[model samples]
Target: MTLCLLTITTPSAVEDVIVDWFLEQEDIGDFNSMPAFGHGSHEGKMSVAERVTGRSRKTMFQLHLSLPTVERILAKLKKDFAGTEIHYMMSPLMRAGDLTAYEA
Candidate 1:
């Protein structure tokens, strides 16, 4: 199985919901999330405050999983979070491991 990084961005309004959803997924071992700002004129997506600042509040979730697992999770996300301004991207992971375990 090829390892890959999956990133999902969502409106701040549904950040908790997204987190809860991820927790329910058995395929996911763990994930990381942080508050972020999305900069773009996405039309009808930005709130008044966001429009003034030219960036919308967003929450980004990232996880490392196998290629097939990532695809399956993405498909499930598409069906469950439809119309929720949820966006995602996946990138291949060349390597991931602990760097301090090596003995000189």
Candidate 2:
């Protein structure tokens, strides 16, 4: 089985819900999160003029899970977040955990 590292970035307002989604998944565990900022124009409290001159601020979440689990979560996210600014990236894990054990 392939292990994947999944990273997601979305508005801070949705951080709790986004993190909760992973908590609800049986195959996923031990994730990390922190605040982040993205330089870009986006629809928000800012008007068109403000958006053009502003950068989007949001939270980023990361986790590791089996490929099948990533696929399941991504499929739903792609459909449910259509036209929204939610962005995700997945990387093939080369090695994980401590020296006690390792897997690519």
Candidate 3:
């Protein structure tokens, strides 16, 4: 098995819901972790653009998870949040200095 990093981004208001859904998935196994930081832009009333704008935008939240069960978790996410945006990156770890030009 390989270590995988799962990063999820969703509307801020529904951030808790997304996190909870992942937690409940049985495929997640015993390896899971929270996001290192939460960030995004939200609609503000104080901004001059807001006065001219007629719509409120959704905020974004990012979460990180370490797990080997990638397929199952991804399936669950797709089923639960069909319309939400999701992005993921999978990489394998190599021996130290394996990819660099350095003396052992």
Which one is best on TM-score? 1
Question: Per-residue lDDT for 17 in model 1?
Answer: 94
Compared with the true structure, what per-residue lDDT tens digits does model 1 show for residues 15-61?
A: 99999999999999879999988997773567788799899888999
Q: lDDT of each model, Cα atoms only?
A: 0.88, 0.79, 0.50
- Per-candidate TM-score against the hidden true structure: 0.90, 0.75, 0.49
Off by over 4 Å in 2: 42-53, 79-83, 99-104
- If both were scored by TM-score, which would come out higher, candidate 1 or candidate 3? 1
Per lDDT, what order, best first? 1, 2, 3
Q: How many residue pairs collide in each prediction?
A: 0, 0, 0
- Model 3 scores a TM of 0.49
Task: Using lDDT, give the best candidate's number.
Answer: 1
Kindly give the stretch of ten consecutive residues in candidate 2 with the minimal lDDT sum.
Answer: 41-50
Tell me how far the alpha carbon of residue 19 in candidate 2 is from the true structure, in angstroms, after superposition: 1.7
